[model samples]
Target: MNTIEEEVPLGRRRRRRYSVEFKAQVVAACQGPGVSLAAIALHHQLNANLLRRWVEQAEGNERFLVARSEVSVPSAATPAFVSLPLETRNARTGEIRVEVRRADQSITVSWPTSEAAQCAAWLREWLA
Candidate 1:
């Protein structure tokens, strides 16, 4: 007693649109030296793996890093440290701070005293 109409399905996919400016920025960040792809991707909330693919595709292009100096790091007397401020997890008596070396990217966790050593270690390992 009921009549039904036939349904149709479109098998085509939609094309995504990206601005030229965005593509240029991505390309620049990918090729820029002294900056990690991880950091760039993190800033843009993009996947590092995908950004690496873009870099690979852009390799040998005019925009690529033609000079070796762009990627070289000079030796310094003191290692640069980056303060990675840690949020207090609990109401503890001691304080902890995580720092990463800008020169070598090494991470170091410091505590106020020996009593906080365990907490510092945990933060270091967990952050790593």
Candidate 2:
């Protein structure tokens, strides 16, 4: 069954121990395109839940290893946050503007920027 039976000291209970290679093989099968995990588990004579846990552990370990390797590699081209100059406008003079055009009629509405919530509600009702 591709597993080793280990006898526990406490009782007559024996635990099944799967090799790393066998686990990797099963996990790879589960990751195949359009593959059913339950079907794979049945083929391997393993419980579906245990196979699922193996798959999760494999994926999590892969992610952790990848993250660790990335952190170890130092690249000059790696992106870093840089401050950029932004155009600043007076908030008191700012207006929430909306332009609506239908057929040949055009309407322009401007609301105070401070009442943005009310302007949004009004715009929603107007559009609806």
Candidate 3:
């Protein structure tokens, strides 16, 4: 009875309230390039987890949805890296040689650094 009486005076602590504009600013900082959400939260003396929730809420907003809908999403299946066989000649000579192997078939091509685009196009054509 005494403990209840004592607790009644303190009651529950009030929850912290933040303005929408402040939340939007923090969320925007989290989205900036090379910006860390935890660092931002620490700088602002806020909980990182709370900032992440705000980010989720912002992303789910109708404004974000409309902007996201305008951007094209790539296919889930990304292109695999092709095995690029490298051959090096003498160190004195700076030349590039790329070899591709498919089952029993193999191809060898040598190109100067300046003609890399042509070499890439030729490789693509040959592979196709």
Instruction: Give one digit per residue, the lDDT tens place, for model 2 in 1-128.
Output: 53654545776766678766667667766665567999989998999999999888877897533443433332225356899987545355788777889999998888888899999999789779
TM-score for each of the candidates: 0.33, 0.42, 0.41
Worst 10 residues of 3 by lDDT: 1-10
Q: Positional deviation of 12 in candidate 1, in angstroms?
A: 15
lDDT on C-alpha atoms for all candidate structures: 0.58, 0.73, 0.68
User: Best to worst by TM-score, what's the order?
Assistant: 2, 3, 1
lDDT preference between candidates 1 and 2, better one: 2
Q: Which portions of model 2 show Cα errors greater than 4 Å?
A: 5-11, 63-128
Candidate 1: regions farther than 4 A off: 1-17, 61-128
What are the per-model numbers of colliding residue pairs? 0, 0, 0
The predicted structure with the larger lDDT, 1 or 3, is: 3
lDDT of 3 by residue, 14-35 (tens): 5567655566566766665567
In lDDT terms, which candidate is top?
2
The stretch of ten residues in a row with the least summed lDDT in candidate 2 is 67-76
